[model samples]
Target chain A: MTKRKMFLRMITASLLRRRSRMLIALLSIAVGATILSGLVTIYIDVPRQMGAQFRSYGANMIILPGEEGSLTGAVLEEAMQVIPSENIVGATPYRYVRLDMPSRQQSFTTAGTDFDEVRKTSPYFSVEGEYPQNRREIMVGKEVAETIGVRLGSSIELSYKPLASFEGEASADWVPGAALLGSSEGFNEAVLNVSAVLDEEGKISEIEVDALSQTENIGSLVGTDKAFLDQFLGKSLPLTLGEDVDALSGATISSQAVVDALNSSRSRENARLSENKEHYTVAGILSTGGEEEAYIYMSLEDLTRLTQEEIMDVAELSVSASAEELEGYAANIQEEYPALTARLVKRLAKSEASVLSKLQALVFLVTAVVLALTLICVSTTMMAVVSERRREIGLRKALGASDGSIRHEFLGEGMFLGGLGGLLGGLLGFAFAQMVSVHVFGSSITFQPLLLPITIIVSMAISAVSCQLPIKKAVAIDPAIVLKGE
Target chain B: MALLELKNISKIYGDLKALDNVSIRVEKGEWVAIMGPSGSGKSTMMNIIGCMDKPTMGEVLLSGVDISKETARSLTDIRRDKIGLIFQQFHMVTYLTAVENVMVSQYYHSMPDEEEALEALGRVGLRDRARHLPSQLSGGEQQRVCVARALINHPELILADEPTGNLDETNENIVLGLFRQLHNEGTTLIVVTHDPEVAEAAQRTIVLEHGRVAREVINENFGK
Candidate 1:
């Protein structure tokens, strides 16, 4: 017989000679290995599943202005340093301006945004019509567009009320007679041509007003507007001058100036609107279903004019990598930059945290207990075997077998048993893991290719170590007395 | 030439002295028997001479090499190669068949061959029963297998302890005849026994009293 075959035959025969006792040991080993394989599989998959589950919440990380910070674009860029540029998927800045809508005959809030950044950062915004491209083109929310009867190519006036300047912290009830820079009537106004109308969840600049008088025809409204203009201008003048006399009453001029200033700003932005259609394109439109439909979608320049700020308010950042290396990317960003955090969410995050953590902990604890019990079971079995075979060991030694050879024989038996058990256990463990994964997390578990060799090696090592004392005792048996029965 | 020697050998087991200052010599091709009363140290001397045990004092020499200083490994080498052992109880591995039992000795040798084992069994006239296990064989047949095992390695010294002590007359005669055949083949043999009849069957007989050699006698018709 070949050497390996002979050795294997010897091991099999030896094991067979004591099959009843060894079966218990074998069973224990198998159980231990199964638990080990299953738990390890879950451990490696934890972070990936959790990250993805968290990502489904729509926003992974939000960029709020740092404490004691400005919403200016430059300040936003500085805050970007604290964030890992690689982990950010998108960044958008926002600025709001309060203005009057004559068509609505009421005050409304308005928001100016970089449409490209908004589209990249907000997955929730749903647009119904074509997105706005030119400065003259504005997409209004469904609610405001309907009230103004403004279709595509319709011109609308926008007025902005400047923030009241105060030297120190002021209570909400405190009111300045007139804004230090200018009264509302002295502020800027702009006119925008409607390009598209959005569905809902739109944004609008905030403005205060009495009402807009609707004229049946656009031609008749512009034609008879001189007497109306005289009255409008006459009422708007005294309100700014009389604001110091009474801050809360008869200040229609300051209020009307806010409306005019908003319109003027909108018209000026329209002049600068160049539909390059390349660097500047319609990213998306938000449909707030209110004045956002009357509000306009534009570039950073349009947003600055509407908000009366030098730069955009909100900033968005993002990074991309191969699907396989996404986890590494996340880890690298988190490790390299602790100030910023990246999160992957929704279903992946929720399952990973809520389901996987509990499951893994359970598996780990169970595996540890099973492994310890397996070691004890195998060790006891082997000790009994060594004692029973004391005479056999003596005989072999008397026959010129070295102590090393004797030890090798026993260790070989342990290794063989361990490997056989591990193979069987690994198969069972993989099935068990899959079942638990599907039942608990609603996903099929994949068998890892790496566990095969690792299981066998670990099982063999554990068995060998457990068998150490018994094998040594067997090797050191006194042959002379054993042979003579002394 | 002397193949075995003992000088002032003694063996003590706790409070009992199994052998005390015993000395004996056996020449090559000699068939010798050691006779003693119970506890007279004959068995103890046999154990020492066969290298199974060492004397508490004194030395055992095989072919003039002192064996008292030999390590356990070296002593085992002596048992496997230089000295062949046969027991009265047959001492055959019961799991193996007749031929396999004979081949057990060849395991100690570096080059164990099936052909050599078969030839040795054939010499002992047990080739036909080669496939029969020890349990299947009669007492005499099992002893013959043991003889074949001992001769297969062609050891320089053959130590048989009570080779026929547990056998009937027929089996005893069969085993004694085999020893004669081996002695004719130029192998030195030492047989330890308590019976005078068994001692008389050997060419020379040494008697032990207490732990020392008492007397030596020559048998005129050992083989006859």
Candidate 2:
């Protein structure tokens, strides 16, 4: 230990004696180590942090209900009892029903759910209007609102049609199981002319509805009182309701996908006719930039009342969890809810994995390049030291310093610088990672305990490797020539 | 038996025969001064004797060991245990203080001891300036520190080339007085210089001209 200490002292003295040059090399190593440690930390952590971010895209584990169109019993409650609430951000029940738009003579997708929990589950949805609180309103998504010729507070009619419409006399009304040779004649498109909007009072209001889509032909009808609004409050707004023929002028009325010139998928097959009709006003507009953008949402109570069945249309329940543990969570859910199948949102998980892998690769590449540059800088500086201390080395050699002793001094110096550089770099790298994470990802990361040892090892390895040629040069000095001042 | 011996040693630098057919021997505790002008192969012969360079053709024996065929590592051991060297330039690691510079030799020789280094500095009469860096010291003082460093290893052979060549009259007297004191204590020393006064202080003086020994004189009043 004394010998070691003496060697350390010698190296320390040597370093102090050559501060400027050694400082430059130390700074280079520190910079390199900082980049290495910081990027590695980010590479490992970015996936977890970004995965949490993508969780806002919604569920990683989606548990489908027993049957395709319905859940059995108070099955959602059973599912809740089975799943640990700590892991659950949202466990909402949903019901899907066909919405018949009499104004547009078509059916659309209307979803029924508790909107409050949905806010937590899919927080990335950018809502333009407020969410509905009661059974008397509907939340129309952006694509639906654009496809449908409706905006906030516009009255629409939806008819329930779970099955096919049969051949019958084409009347103003369409009902299921009737031989309705459905023709576009005697169809009385409901014309709601709002006299006044009653704010929680049995009053009158005037509402002028302008059909935004060319397929829609809305006419005005004078309406007043609570009964009028209530009767027209729970209807489904089909995606094709507001088609303004004047806007389309010489064009055909179709869906949002067909409203463009480049849409090749828009055909006559995408249309639907409803057997029964109910009315509701558009209460909200939601924009999510996802599949949820095309949905019409309502409360389950209103949907049940309209369908005249205790309708539990919850076909699936999506649970928010991390990607790594999601599969295990899914398996646990399956063991508990034997009738239900719990599976991961594989596409989302896969894409997130792909992104994380790419980022890790990029960090590795940058780290490698930085390390190479560090080796070159350190090696060059050490070589300069060798050149400067030629006389000193030669003197020591003549004074009976063995090759091992000379090597020991330089090796100690290299390791000391490496260790010091690593320590400084590790701390600075963590700080930099925090800054980047907070600035770019808008979130903070946790500290990794493993980074310390990793940086030290890498720094030491670099230093030792860089010292090889310089040490050889130092030990190879000829005392005779240098003592002669040659 | 001689403490140091060279049998027909020849040192060649490419085409220049720096030392040709030179053979010399010195008994234990002998104080010898090797006198030669520049390029007379004085430095070359010293280098071979000091184990800094191998003789191109000859046998060298130190303390009865034929080390002429020794490898560099073994030569290093011989140099550490039996030989010490000094130069006119006072080649100190300029950054280290006097004490640390002396300790450096001790460090390579064995374990470095701070007290021993201070004692060595005291021997050179630079005890008070032990903490001074080489640059802070006067030229003669730096040379004294180099002397301290060379003696710190306790070698049997101290080979000093131009020990007082760069010193002033008073500094040279002071340095030569230390050498005379060490020689009286029976330390073997080979002082290489062209100064007749420096050679006169030795028990024997060997003169070289053009790489061969020209003359050898025995000094009867070396101490007086």
Candidate 3:
């Protein structure tokens, strides 16, 4: 037999004598190796998937009115002129009102806009019933429909609270109470017809108002309310009706205040939407399974009106250029529009990559722990084998076996265990990763081919570490005492 | 010049003396028997002569080189290259076949020859049983295998510690006959035993009492 063959045979014979004990050690090493391989595979893939999921939600940028901080028509016109028209798909100005759904006691903030432009900008809205073709039809969010007991073809009674501010009496110093009806000025309310119910596609919702009322014709109604105040030029009076809470409540103005705050926020969001018409649109309503679904949608123009902010707040313009050109575009935009910030949000497959990285880290940690523990087991097993064969070792020493030969024998045994376990672990780890991915990520996972080499290398390292201690112990055995039992 | 020599050899275990100032010498081609009752330190003397153990205070000169000054490792080399050992129980590795047991001795030598192993086995009349494992061989056959193993390296010194002690009369006689044949071939031989019959088989006998050499005599008609 060749020297190597003889050495291997010695190891095999020794291991075979105690196969049962060694099998457990082998299994432990294999398990550790498998986990290492599988987890590493996942760590490399998560970011790309996550990034894709985020991209699916279209709002990569937001635009606001100019630094002048005014929503004047002239300002909007100037902003529009500055941005190229070909880049802007749709734009509409927005106005908002606070409405209280008395039946459900739910507050809905409404955004008034040109529905034609709004529909064109936001296409993800899944309308259960046909959308309104004219100004009278109003689309409602699905959560609002469920709460207010209103559906398509149903006319919902929405009371829009009129502003109770007394004009020309230091209007800037006026703080309106919660109840408009019981306040110094009487409450103003209006009603609208529900045209369609929209599913939760990509809707924006606030905490207080229901999402359905975002599209109510709040502008025309608020304008009319202001016209009514123009009629009664100067009046400060608190008007109380009969003992009917439904008709007029006192402290329910907080709900109206919530609706107002929601409306103002929605209008501002709309202005930003219009300002960045190229990058964003009214995707859909965010139902969130809560009472606060009251939100608004607008075309890019309407967002510009409501937000009353700078053009930089709204528009995200992308030039038809290569990756290298993106830096130049950003630089040019920065220099030309010094007030505006241009960021290159690369559509990186980061989400999937991050998921992969995390999975990789987890896999590495698990593998390390497994291999460490297995090394301990292997070390123990080797120690036992060495101790058990002290007499044999001494006899071999006496019979002229070199220290290298003895050490080689034990190393061969360790490597055999490691390699065997690694092979088994690699196969098992692949299956394990597949199972975890399918169960956790809810998708089928592709097996990475590289895990095989990684598993083998890791297993070998574990065996090498595990064998060192026992090999040292074996080397320390005194030949004379061991052989003659002196 | 003596092929093997011991001067003032003594071995002490705590306060008790296992061997006290035991001195002996054997020239080339001589068969010497060391006889003693149990605990007379005959086994200890054999161990020292076989290089299996070192004396506490003594000089073991093999071919005129004092081995007491050699390191334990170098002593092992000396044992492997110069002396061949046989045990009372025929300590052939049981797992190996008869020929393999003989070949095992050659492992210590730098150049092991298969033909030399076969010839050694043939000298001990164990050539026919060469393929049989130690357990499969008869008692006499096992002793012959052990003898073959000891002689395979053709060492200058052969130390047999009660080689036929565990054997029947016929096997003992066969083993003794093999030894006589090997001695005639000019190999120095030392046999440690308490059996008078075994001692009578040797050309000279050394008697020990109380860990000391009591007497040494050359038989006029040894094995006649």
Candidate 4:
């Protein structure tokens, strides 16, 4: 037989002779390896799973107007383009406006937002009925509906006077410039400089009008137009021609033409003021127990049409990413768009990070404790084996066995046990991790293929280190004394 | 030149002297016996001669190489090359079979040869029991296995310390007969024992008393 074969035979026989003791050591090593593999898997994957779980709570980030003091739909779209789409769960832009209720003599705050985006960003908000589907439909909060004395399907009339400079005073007239009028044949242009004077209570106290028509026959009636425009004095806006004002005498078509010009000028001015008066049906009641319960919500499309501007005050975003990654995205957005401020909701981000880190720390601590205990247990068992074999060691030494050879035998037994236990533990550990993940996190963990080799190497290292003290004790045996029956 | 020499060997254990001013010599192919009472330093002298230990002060020249000054590692090499030891307790590895036990010695000395190891066991009349563990063998059979293991490497000196002490009279005679056969084959033998019959089989006997060589006797009836 070869020396190597003989050596292996000797070590194997020795281990087999003390099967019970060696079995204990093997079990300890296996348990240690199991914990090592399982906990490491958890520590690496917890952040991703926890980040996803936390995203369900609400939006953890908000984008607001920067130094420009105003945000637009185009700017929000541009900012969203820079972020990866997969990371974004939802991003909803919000626009706020206040409209007066003429009959109630009160103003109600209103917010315009996309309902589809809100479902993702603010899943916690519950609507009593349903979100508005059209411009004529609106959703009011519980407090808004209570204050307005309106229910689902009830109509609300809201109005807002034109706040532009041309509304209350004769600052300018609708000239259309000479080129625009002259470009079209048979088109008569008129300049109507109309102004309303309001009292302290916002009631129209007086009205004035100056009309100049480019039509050839209408130029001579400047004195007569004073009487014609005087009929509108002391009247309130949203006035209708022929209903609120008397028609001029004799020249009926000419009078109708002047009235048409007046109505066209007012329509152009009202576009900037955004529909001075409108009626809407209350489609839903929002019952959120927060500030949102006191405001009226509508579609952004309708709000844009009314305000004649595509602008938003702020945008709320829900992203599926860790706090650090969100910070990186926020930094990138701010750098790219100086007029936009991206902020993370610190409470949610910090809580998610804190919980995940603590869980990882706990896993690490448990793994460390298990490994230490395994080392101690295996070391003690090996020491006992060495003690039991003192006479055998002495006999070998007397038979001209070197200290190095004696050490080799004991180390060989230990490493062999370690390798066997490591393989068993690798398979068991993955199952252990899978069970824990499914039970605790309600999700299945991804298997890491690299951990198998790592576990085997670590087990072998533990076994080799555990053998050092026992090997030392074995090598210190004195053949003369031990063999002499002393 | 003497094949083995110990000049003024002294072995001290703290305040007690196990061997003091002891000197002995044996020529090549000589069979000698050492007889002594307990605490007479017989085992201590044997230990030093077998390279298991070093004397406190002495020069042990085996084949003209002073081994007293050798390092522990060098002593192991010298022991494997030139000396073979048989213990009184028959200290065979309990797990290995008889043949494997013999092969262990050959393994440390050089490459193990199972055929050679089985032949060695055959010489000791243990060929039939070659596959039995030490626990399965009787006292005399276990002792024979030890003898086979010691003789497997063809060492220059065979050191047997009370080799038949644990055996019955019949088994003892069997072991003594094996020692005589080996001696006839020109192999050196050193027997440490308290039995007069065992001592009488040797060419000469050295008796120790209280750590010193008190006397030496020659066997009168030779070769006949």
Instruction: List the lowest-lDDT window of 10 residues for candidate 2 chain A.
Output: A259-268
Query: What lDDT does the true structure give each of the candidates?
Result: 0.62, 0.72, 0.59, 0.79
For residue A116, what is the lDDT in candidate 4? Answer: 86
Candidate 2: share of reference interface contacts reproduced: 0.58
- Which has the higher TM-score value, candidate number 2 or candidate number 3? 2
How big an interface RMSD has model 3? 4.2
Off by over 4 Å in 1: A1-9, A45-372, B35-38, B88-104, B124-145, B163-177, B193-200, B205-210, B214-221
lDDT of 3 by residue, A1-486 (tens): 234444454567556756777787787788777777666655444433333333333222223343445344444445444445553444444444445555554556555555554444443345555545542345566666665656556655445433332333322221222112111111223222111111233122112222222223342232223332132222222111221111112323322432333222212212221111111222333343433245433333433333443232233332222334445555554555544444544553233345445656766677667667888877887788778777666655555555665687778888888888888988887787778766766655667777787788779778888889888888766545322213
Model 4 Cα lDDT, one tens digit per residue, A1-486: 899999988888877876888889889889888888888877777776676678778888899999875788788888987778988889988887765566774556678899889888888888877888877788899988997799999998765433332253221332322100000011122222334444544334544432222232353242247776676555444346578766665444445544443333332344232236778889999887898988888888877776666888889998888889889889998999998999999999889888987887898889889888888988998999889888988888888889999999888998988887787787788889888888988899888899888888888889899999999999999878544545
Question: How well is each residue in A70-161 modelled by candidate 2, as lDDT tens digits?
Answer: 46437656766555676666765677665657676444567887787677666776777688886668898888888877899888887664
Candidates arranged by DockQ, highest first: 4, 2, 3, 1
Name the regions of candidate 2 deviating beyond 4 angstroms: A66-92, A101-106, A143-148, A155-281, A288-294, A308-324
Q: After TM-score superposition, what is the CA distance of residue B157 in candidate 2 from its true location, in Å?
A: 0.9
- Candidate topping DockQ: 4
Chain A TM-score of each candidate structure, as shown: 0.49, 0.70, 0.51, 0.69
User: Best candidate per lDDT, number?
Assistant: 4
Looking at model 4 chain A, which ten-residue stretch has the lowest summed lDDT?
A: A178-187
Give every collision pair in model 4.
Answer: none
Candidate 4: C-alpha lDDT: 0.79
What count of clashes does model 4 give?
Answer: 0
